[model samples]
Target: MTKPQGFVSKDRNLHVCKAEAAASASPADEQPLLGEPEQPKFLGIELVTLKKIIPLGLMFFCILFNYIILRDTKAVLSVTAQGSSAEIIPFSKTWVYLPMAIGFMLLYRKLANFLSKKALFYTVIVPFIAFFGAFGFVLYPLSNYIHPQEFADKLLNVLGPRFLGPCAILRIWSICLFYIMDELWGSVVIFVLFWGFATQITTVDDAKKFYLLFGLGANIALIFSGRTVKYFSMMRKILGRGVDGWAISLKAMMSIVVVMGLAICGLYWWVNTSVPLPTRSKKKEKLKMGIRRGA
Candidate 1:
């Protein structure tokens, strides 16, 4: 019983194509494992190196703006709840967000069956942008009519720290909704969507180089957000107090938030198209070159 002309010893690669037979003969066993070397450095920080980290850096920039808005929007809502003066714990913030986390996780799990990580990312981005746009342009303006300040003040005596209650505002429920939204965005957007998209684009080797810097980049956004708030306040001053200045400021900030969301989507598109992360089919080819099964 003779073997066929181009048959191989390996069970898996036995049926491999003629051109690829030599390559797939021993996919994972052939490469010599080497110790990590001192990465090439120019200024203590590997400014000039043998790898690409710029795409990760761009992803981090998008995360910076996204997370900053998540932080400040929550801060603004918390402040607004006490008439822009103080904050009240409307039930434990922790308790409020826990069920939200569970629900989001369930939604994401279901969506994962039908959508790629990229699609899930946009699904998250679009709704939030639409909500903020409506808030800035329409709902916020009608807030006084929808949930009047006079009504809020009447409740002040029952729930008071001062002249107003701990949770007294023209749109009391809207403030709480935004507060909860901010929490959900931090959980879903930062931890799930951004990282899920990042994982698709990154390899273990790439993670070693970029993940720390990614964290540092996001934290720095905290410093910039104060300056951003100041700039918007200036915009309000220029627009004039009696002429719906806060609305002008909110609209301007919301416009920038939409742009940041676009930047994240664009970066995801670029990483997927231009750099092209490996798929399962490509992974077989790479394994032929040296990568181990679990490595």
Candidate 2:
């Protein structure tokens, strides 16, 4: 009799998962499917009867960290954009940006096929995180000066600038790029992939009973993110009084994003390494047979 997936031995250890044991034997393997498990400890407080519950906490933490930064990034961008409202183009009132979205989706399809999940995750996400870091110290400070009135005038001449102002054109252009990259952090990272990751390692039953606890992480992130945005706002106001307050705040926010990115990465590493998903049935049997033969 084969044990069901996510099987645990007699000790009823919350962390034990046969699939993880088999999969963890190798370093570079895909995460294993979830199996039936013993009741796991909830919040490390009360011992719950639900099976395969503990490991999913790792997934929850990852989601929490992702939102803590991504949501904050959205707020930061909004604040920055508001501060520089004079520069923003009024194209948002129109549907002119639809073509660009269509173009991006077309490109995204090809890249999804070409890149492995891990590689694709890094390729898309790492750069965005790095951008936040670089933006903090670099692009943001020079932003007001970067797109001069001269360049805006040249763009107006060549691009058929109708009713929009030159500064507005430059601001809109910068914002478009920022919006695409920032949106991807949520779309590709959280909704598309991360949710799938949670589903991959959890059974329907376990997910149903305990998912609410997992969802609580989002609220925690929301609260923490609000505070983070507030702190940055205050710091920018007090410290950046002599200089550009908005620029200073943008930098501070981006730096925080980088730090959160690091924490997320470390949590991801721990999730994969320590609480790995279950491996295939055959692999487990093979390993067991080999061990018995060796003994």
Candidate 3:
């Protein structure tokens, strides 16, 4: 009889079978069963993730740059204002800034109930820009008339030298107002608005990866704003005497602030426009699915 097809003799079986040999092989000895997936990335961040983060980072940079500038400028304006000293800072922080912060928190809670995020941002931000611009251009020019010098002097006499700090704050009330608003900028913009928006849009995993990168923009702002502050501080020297250089510097700083504020608004608008609503919804949905699967 002829040998049957698909039959293996005992001699053939004694040798290593091809299928079994392949199965026994290590992964390193074989090619991948499927092609590896390709991801477009820059500096380890996926392109899509970078697209979402860069505009947000620019927004953060502008916000932080304004904050740094205002912080330095406010200290100089408050401490050097007529009758005021560095001592006013403690009183301002304890009494004025604290109360304003508390009031803002309460107001924010109320606003959150009804207003959209963009409306809330503009509402909070525009007033700051307006006030700073007014202070630099309109209000500071009238400081001699606006400040209650005689009243502060009378109060100082009655309250004695012990009350100089409070009296000083009363005298330079416009400067005090500037001080408080600058303090609020740091707290409200960075903590409440920017971070809140960031966390809302980004998934947890993305936040973990990119929040540090976002923070790096703020750190870089320190360098840029510091150099700006230094330049403005030395403007009187740079521009020479009898030129009202400090006033010029104030205008320049405030103008930069307005520009940066508008840039922040533009970046905020870009983020909303560029990152589609569907992408955010999908990210949230995917995050929810991940949570469910993990559970």
Say which candidate scores most in TM-score: 3
Task: Write the residue-wise lDDT of candidate 3 on 1-295 in tens digits.
Answer: 7667546575477565866887899844765457865557788676767777888899899999999999999888987888888899999999889989878877776665577778988898889988988988988878999999999999999999988878898899999999999999998888888887887767787888778887689889999999998988877687866787878899899999999988988888887878753255334322221322321
Candidate 1 vs candidate 2: the TM-score winner is: 1
lDDT of each: 0.63, 0.57, 0.83
Distance (Å) between predicted and true CA of 250, model 3? 0.9
lDDT of 2 by residue, 126-244 (tens): 77778767766876566666645566666667767463443454544455456445656665667655675567556575567677887676676677777877777677657634687
lDDT of 1: 0.63
The local lDDT score (0 to 100) that residue 68 gets in candidate 2 is 63
Q: List the residue pairs that clash in candidate 1.
A: none
For each candidate, give its TM-score against the true structure.
0.66, 0.63, 0.78
Q: Give me the overall lDDT of model 3.
A: 0.83
lDDT of 1 by residue, 51-148 (tens): 23565566567666756765676676567543544534345264556667677666666666577667777887778767766776776677666666
> What is the alpha-carbon lDDT for the whole of candidate 2?
0.57
